[model samples]
Target: MNKKTDLRVLRTNQSIRKAFYELIQEKGYEAITIQDIADRAMINRNTFYLHYQDKPDLLDRCVEELLEEIKNAIVQCPISMRPFSISTLETVMQTILEHISHNTSYYQAMLVGENKIYLFQSKMEKIIKDKLNEGWTSSQGKSTLKISKELLLEYLVSAFMGVIIWWIKNDLPLPVEEVSSQFSKIVAYGHFKAAGIAVEE
Candidate 1:
């Protein structure tokens, strides 16, 4: 497509997405309808359907974009940084923080509503799994289910999600860097144990 055509499509999709997001913030996902999104976007139901198959499809696309942004951030991260290091964790935190910051109202609504929580958590889980896979390669006989690497990564991801939820609920009192540094230390200890780099005294 030509640049103008591409821009128009992007602009239309963004408008529809924004309307849905606003509806979600106001009455939540369960109450939101295609008509509501179309009304808010000043577009007809046909336009909404043209851009997205359904509400869930739109949400899935939104989360996919977020995940892609996260992957890109990690890929662009400095190679000198150690995995699960404080610096590395900050990079992760920065991505989350930026997203939350950018969509504070939307996230706040999601946090307050019961329906969106599962979707948010699942998205976070996928991001963690992707990042863990990026950081570790599997060896022969080392199935992800039975390996310490996977176990530790799962634990760390769970912890990170918990902290993120808490931070968002609490209005993010501390700096993201400070909170993530502490999380990194906790995760680093786990990584050390998993990788046989440290022995318990």
Candidate 2:
């Protein structure tokens, strides 16, 4: 039946992707081949070809699929970004962290080690930057910002990415809410305030 055929196709695609991700972590992306993927997936090279044109195609799809999920989640967050509220940062980050928790292995393979795919990291940062950029407006009526929008955005995105990598690299030490809250606090206040260090008045 056509239904059964579609189900089979779905299962096979899952297998292929799972194999590709595992191999990325174990062997590094540059070292993996279609045959390696097929063997790890327990499928033949022909099956891999049926789903993807080549290894590059498979890698592209894997990155695209994950990034698309992130984009979708970001789009769903209704928080405003201008002025950089703690609640806004927490909400958006919580959404992303929750989503990442569901697929830690894929992220680990793409982001955690020497084997990490820089392309995935770059694309993911771009997604975050684009989302953050969407919330900023020129401070026409408000007080002028001491920092440039570009610089602030860069800091937020880099720090966000660093925390995420640290979270995964350390096996997610803190719960999502706690991590987001801490990150939000540090951003809204200074690190000294977030850490309870008394500032010299």
Candidate 3:
């Protein structure tokens, strides 16, 4: 049946992805080949070709899948719980943190010796920007923020990405909830207060 075939294909793809991750960790991405992946995945080169055009295609799909998962998590977060509230932000942050934590090894591997940081940062910025645009548009002109939407998106994305990279590099010393809470506070209340910076009225 078509359903059974789909299931089998799914399993094959998962196996290939898992193998690719393991190989990347062990041998690095530049050193990996399709044959190597197929050997590790217990599939033939022809089977690998059937599923993916090449190793780069596989990597692209892997990153795309991660982005899709993150986007879905953000989209599914319940806005009605408390729209634009720190609690809601914390929930969203927690979802993101949990995803990163769950795939720590993969992230670590991807982030090293490459410009992959931009890949993640840009994708996250787009997702957050889209979400914020939705919120702003739905606010019925009641939202009053002095900053441009583009700048706000860049600032948020950069800040979050910096923290995430630092956390990952340090092996995530703090718990996800604690980090999320701290990040939410920093976003809700500017860091100038914590740093004792006086603002000119």
Candidate 4:
């Protein structure tokens, strides 16, 4: 589409998403409806439907946008910030921590209960797979590595999500950088240990 049309579509989608996010925060996924979103955005139900089939579709789109940005953040590691380094882990954690911190209002609205846990699982699964791929090789054979990788990925993602949820539920009294620094060390180093890789202190 032309630039003007693109901008219009973007603006409309943002309005709808902002409305949905606010309502979800005040209530929950189950309580939200297309009419509520339309009312909040001051748009007609037809306008809302033009962008999304329903509330869940809107949520999926929102989550997809968040994940795409997150993936870019992770993959665009600087040359000085190689993923193998502790400092690199800290950097990655810091980027995500900042995202979470900056969007505290949005997260504070929806990131609790099942929603929080779901976000954690969905976001970390790719990271876990990457880490697994990095450390595993053909020497371990496909079958063994496949099973081990899956199990490890599941465990680490669940553990990381659990920790974050606990921190959030406790009101996030600690500074995010501190919490994320410790998390990077604990998670990345712990993975090194699990994979029998030597850590340089």
Ordered by TM-score, highest first, the candidates read 2, 3, 1, 4
Clashes of each: 0, 0, 0, 0
* Alpha-carbon local distance difference test for all models: 0.69, 0.90, 0.76, 0.65
Q: Each prediction's TM-score against the native?
A: 0.69, 0.94, 0.76, 0.66
Question: Which 10 residues in a row give candidate 1 its minimum summed lDDT?
Answer: 77-86
Error of 1 at 82 (Å): 8.5
| lDDT of model 4, residue 1 | 61
Where is model 3 poorest over a 10-residue stretch in terms of lDDT? 111-120
Clashing pairs in 4: none
Model 4 spans > 4 angstroms off: 1-8, 78-85, 108-110, 114-120, 126-152, 167-172, 187-201
Top candidate when judged by TM-score against the true structure: 2
* Model 1: residues with Cα > 4 Å off, grouped in runs: 1-8, 78-84, 105-112, 133-148, 186-201
Q: Encode model 1's per-residue lDDT on 1-201: one tens digit a residue.
A: 699998987898988877876787678788888889889988899878888889889888877776566566556543222223556666776667766766666566555455454676677677766665555552233343554766767776787777777887788887876777766666656656644676768
Q: How many backbone clashes does candidate 4 have?
A: 0
lDDT of 1: 0.69
Cα misplacement distance, residue 158 of candidate 2 (Å): 0.5
- The residue-level lDDT of candidate 4 at 100 comes to 63
> In candidate 2, where is summed lDDT lowest over 10 consecutive residues?
136-145
Better of 1 and 3 by TM-score: 3
Q: Which stretches of candidate 3 lie over 4 Å from their true place?
A: 1-11, 23-31, 78-84, 112-120, 192-201
Ranking by lDDT: 2, 3, 1, 4
